[model samples]
Target: MTERYSRQERFTPIGPGGQAQLANKHVFIVGAGALGCANAEMLTRAGVGKITIIDRDYIEWSNLGRQQLYTENDAASLKTKASAAEQRLRAMNSEIKVQGIAQEFEAETAEALVDGADFLIDGTDNFQTRFVINDVAAKIKVPWVYGGCLKSYGIVLPIVPGTTPCLHCLIDHLPQEGSTCDTVGIIGPAVQMTAAYQSAECLKFLTGHSMTVEMVYADVWGREYSSINISGLLNPECPSCSRDAVFPYLKKEKGLKTAMLCGRNTVQVRPDQLSTLSLSDLSSHLENVTDRMKENAELLMFHVEDVRFVVFKDGRTLIHGTENVEEAKKLYQKYIGA
Candidate 1:
């Protein structure tokens, strides 16, 4: 409401009237990685009232190249992306109410974290999380923007509940295979451009501006851009958007429990539900097992053999130097006492 947003308000599409609408809107941003970080910052600066950011990983030195919200100190301290992003974004705009959730977006907690939001944005790196977001958005009738990037290429699609084609309609099943950011490497510009387009679409929807909605695909490195005609995919037989199928992504499924986090050479293990541990207490206990244990209130970092385990207070851990979940879990139980 001050001169801080005068430039944005001066725009014909987002005058003072549309700015007010943005002030009342609430958006849930899933995944605080490359795409999430960029989009969250833009949305906050654009005057979106409240934003809830969720991510389970911590900042690493490698993240600094593309995840701009993090600092070297944050990476050194192993700050969770959500916590670090909240600190940086609040400093960017105090009027924007931002909540950082240092937790993974899974079936058990996905709905609770995403519920009641005016819109959802996909910044996640993996298909498992995206499917969860897509299912929830379709079931609740909330609009969502899905954006992804890898190796100087990215895609953005906006789904307006009953109007457009839901994400699942574009595919019969999850991609059995795909190259990750770690495998192919991502350019920072691709992430920024994709996030900017996604944020712009979000603003358009919130401001009652009717724009041509289409799936945007861009290869910034190759200088190629194309959009597919998906308007016809919104069929009445569509399981998610039209037929009202029960979102199965909200249900638990068995798969590879190991994941090599994008942008880092770390693998995460999805442990069975367990009681939470205080970082300090776990650190103290770990000292008896390993002489290289280090702990703060938020995280515990220790080295055992060639791998390093960075465990957060919420029971999620990142095991560096290997992509073996079984081995990671073994290391977690050995040092952190399960």
Candidate 2:
């Protein structure tokens, strides 16, 4: 028995054989927020060989409460969540390999990110991204664990390509009306519960143990818990899985109008389709903003009162200090152009 994993290997559910299986397996986790950070930490300590953390947004003060891997300095620095999580995980288990990709996992990027991953775990906050993950997991025949948390409640589902109903099939059973994490507010316990569930489900699959494909739902405050069998709920005609239709979210190529980033008071504004931008040239034309502009090879940033914006060469601007999409777009027009 490995000394580091002696206690874990002693567990009857995952003995020596299971420990061997976990080593060197690649698990791609999308989103490095609360659940993502928690899951990555748990799996890393458990000695999962390789983990790839993908996240597009940066860290903020609001994230420190629930996300375990980040520090106050990370939030203040606006550090990319994936990169920060990777740094922390590597330090936790230097023997394991961890990679962080600081970019959105959209249709255009999903295949490359999910390819060769033994398990996919959803820590993303949006349904659109979840749909893209579903398509990729199905196409690749890799099992994925879907987890979502809002306020004090959370849900977990272990999805097997041919054996279990996919995420799309669970759409019909979703709550029709409810407060989101942003409005009602998500507590730390809910996030941890969901992450714990997701990590356990991933371990089951990786260790060759029979996985429970039920939808495990929990409410920490209400003290409510239930598990619903999803086998019968499988949508026979679901386009994503049953018929294997082309993925719409995967057809993505530029043209993002207004995107509200997760957990940050920010929004992204861009042209219908990206056009190459010259940051140095654009900087010369701006006025009334802070004289001190932060510029690097990849992006240019300047602050105007409450709002700070970063511009990329790909005609994309992330407007910080605001959640309103329209305000972000207006700022983009005023500064980055129409």
Candidate 3:
């Protein structure tokens, strides 16, 4: 180990052997928000050989306070989180390979993106996406660290397939609906604390240490912390991680057509069949119908009435100003056409 990782390598538990193991490991991270950014930076500096991060959202002014990899310029330009994070991670550790995928990690693309990863990390904020990650991890027999934060509280769990309880085991206890960062708000320390726990678990796993599967909960502001062994939560009958696992979440459904972004007052609309869209042609076509139109290589931004429209090359349109799927779908059909 060089001077770069000298300190980390000298930390008895992760000495030279662990450092060597980390150099050859590939970690796949989902989401590029607060947790994702923090986790990526830590792993990169720890000399992880390769890391792949996928995220669908773009950076915004509100993200700068906690999402570590983004800058004011990235937010101003509306750069996708994955691409922006990739650029920063590469700069941090040129010796390691970092690939940031700018797309949604749904059932359709989840398995493929996590193909060669040694393990997975959850940086995603929503449960829907986490379920997809859980499904992918269980199907491939890969371990994943789950972390979530809201307000001052956060939770972390490391799920190892066949050995420990998978996410599906705790589905009933997981938050179905509650406060969100946009609503109740979140503290930067909460995000950092959650990400720290998640990163520690990853380090322990990647460094050849036997992982202790546990669900950890903490409230940074309240200064409360607790953990419980979740091994008992493992259900042999779980369709997702059972011995006869069918991986129901990975089954081909028509694909999610519309998703109401939690706490953002935004609705994402995806056509039944995806197609490459020509932004230039679309820009010219919608010039009369839209206002404050902007175009870029990755996506097109415009406004229809009071709503903001962000259209990606893959024909996925994020309709801001409304969380109603029906309303967003109507706008999509009327403006973007069928």
Where is model 3 more than 4 Å wrong at Cα?
A: 172-175
Best by the TM-score measure: 3
The candidate 2 region of ten consecutive residues with least summed lDDT is 172-181
Q: TM-score for candidate 1, please give it.
A: 0.92
Q: Distance (Å) between predicted and true CA of 103, model 2?
A: 0.6
Clashes of each: 0, 2, 0
Better of 2 and 3 by lDDT: 3
Q: List the residue pairs that clash in candidate 1.
A: none
Over the full model, what C-alpha lDDT does candidate 1 score relative to the true structure? 0.84
Per-model root-mean-square deviation over C-alphas: 2.2, 2.8, 1.5
What are the runs in model 1 whose C-alpha is more than 4 Å off? 253-258, 333-338
Angstrom error of the Cα, residue 236, model 2: value is 1.9
Alpha carbon lDDT at 254, candidate 1: 64
182-274 per-residue lDDT for model 1 (tens digits):
678899999998998899998998998864568899999899999986888876766666765767778875633456676567888655563
